[model samples]
Target chain A: AQSVTQLDSQVPVFEEAPVELRCNYSSSVSVYLFWYVQYPNQGLQLLLKYLSGSTLVKGINGFEAEFNKSQTSFHLRKPSVHISDTAEYFCAVSPRGSNYKLTFGKGTLLTVNP
Target chain B: NAGVTQTPKFRILKIGQSMTLQCAQDMNHNYMYWYRQDPGMGLKLIYYSVGAGITDKGEVPNGYNVSRSTTEDFPLRLELAAPSQTSVYFCASSYSLDPDREDTDTQYFGPGTRLTVL
Candidate 1:
């Protein structure tokens, strides 16, 4: 079984400020990590993913994340925030060969203040 | 491609009532899934289908059932609705599930269906 933990429940930040959403996972086998964003009253959109290769993965909307295997962490860091960036972020994990079952974290509500 | 689409943007169900949540995708994805989103809680998979006529249960599949009759549609059925069944339901699809395929890492989601059970 795999599980994910998002450190903060809500993160409020000012526009143009940098922000980071911490995520940690636990699994006995290799896993794939993903970050998804959900706007109010909408479904989730894939922000990025870490399947393999480089530890640093860049995604859409000027978002990037670093995969630290030793720490079992995949924290999403965005250089600057915008009012439109306000949304709920979810971190998920799918163990290798698990038939695509994703274990998601509670989620971090990112509120970008104007 | 219209991606994934779910019907009945919002719904309210009385206790013991039964309803089917419709999900369709134009992307022709081989994998389709049903998930529920609760406040402060992340998504929990209820059921998934690898292809037409092939369905499987996920973590929270007790109260729900699913059917995939075609590559484009996967509907979720609730036999007996209860208060706990109230949540935002999302339908997602992926082109493939082959680990070797890069697209397998991402899933496209629908607008979602908000269901309230009372």
Candidate 2:
């Protein structure tokens, strides 16, 4: 079985400040990592993904994540955040051999205040 | 392209009532999935279909049923509405078997349907 864990449930930060949302996963087999964002009253949208490449992965909206295999972690980072970035973020994992069945972690609410 | 669309964006049902949530995708995707989003908790897969005739259960399948009768449609049936089943539902589709984009199996999501059971 595969599972995802997001350490922080809520993160409050100021606009233009750096932020990091931590995520960890446990899987017996090789897996793919993904980050998704959900704004108020909207469905989730993919932020970034790590499918087997360079450890560092860049995503839209000036966000990035580093997939650390040894640490079993994929943490999403942003150099600076805006008020519009206030949303709930999620981390998910899918095993390589499966048909893209994703296991998602409890979301982290990122509140970027001005 | 209206990649994925769900009908009855909002609904309120009485306990023990039954209803079906309709989902359709215009991207010609081979794979489709249903999920429920609860507060604090992330989305949980309810069911998934690999093609028109194949469907499988996921993390949470109880109190729900799904059918895939065509390439463009997949509907989820709730036999008995319960408060526990009240949540935002999402439908997603992806071209999972496409070999060209093997590394990036991105799933496109529908706008979502909010169901309330009272």
Candidate 3:
């Protein structure tokens, strides 16, 4: 079994400042990690995913996340925040192979202020 | 392509009512899933279909049913709606993850159905 935990429920940051969204997971086996963003009244969009290989992965909207196996964390970071970047971010995990169970965290509401 | 589409963008059902939320995808994916999102509750998996004619329960499958007759459609049925069931529902689809084939576990979501049960 696998589960996800997003550290923050809400994070407020100013535009042009850096921001980070922390996520951690618990599983007895290897799993895939993903970050999704949802705008107001919209569907969740894939921000990025960590299948394998690189520990540091980059996604759209100038977002990046690093997979730290030791800490069991996949934290999302943006170099410079934008007002448009304000949205709900979700961290998810699913076991390897054909297992289709994708567990998601409670989500973090990132509010970017001007 | 219309990755995933869910009909009846918004709906309100009374207690003991029944309804069906339609979901369709054009990606020809072998996997389809239903999820419900509540305020500050993230998302709870309702049901999932591995392929046509194969369906299974997820974390929260109570009060709901699903069938996958075709590769493009997977509709969710609410037998007896309750106020506890009021939430936004989202349908997602993804390609099959084969051991030999490339890994594609990314799930594409629909616009979601805002369900309100009184």
The numbered model that scores best in TM-score is: 3
Q: Pairing residues by index, what is the TM-score of model 1?
A: 0.95
| Candidate 1 lDDT, A1-114, residue by residue in tens | 989999999999999999999999999999889999999988999999888889999999999999999999999999999999999999999876453588899999999998
- Name the top DockQ candidate: 3
Best to worst by TM-score, what's the order?
3, 2, 1
| Collision count of model 2 | 0
Candidates 1 and 2 compared: the better one by TM-score is: 2
Badly placed stretches (over 4 Å) of model 3 are B98-103
Our model 3 lands, by Cα RMSD against the true structure, at: 1.4
Residues B1-118, candidate 1, lDDT per residue (tens digit)?
A: 8889999999999999999999999976898999999999899999998889999998899999999889999999999999999999999988655677667646788999999998
Candidate 3 residue lDDT tens string, B63-104? 999999999999999998999999999999988655444437
- Which is better, 2 or 3, measured by TM-score? 3
Model 1 spans > 4 angstroms off = A97-99, B97-102
Better model by DockQ, 1 or 3?
3
Looking at candidate 1, what is the lDDT of residue B9?
98
Per lDDT, the best of the predicted structures is 3
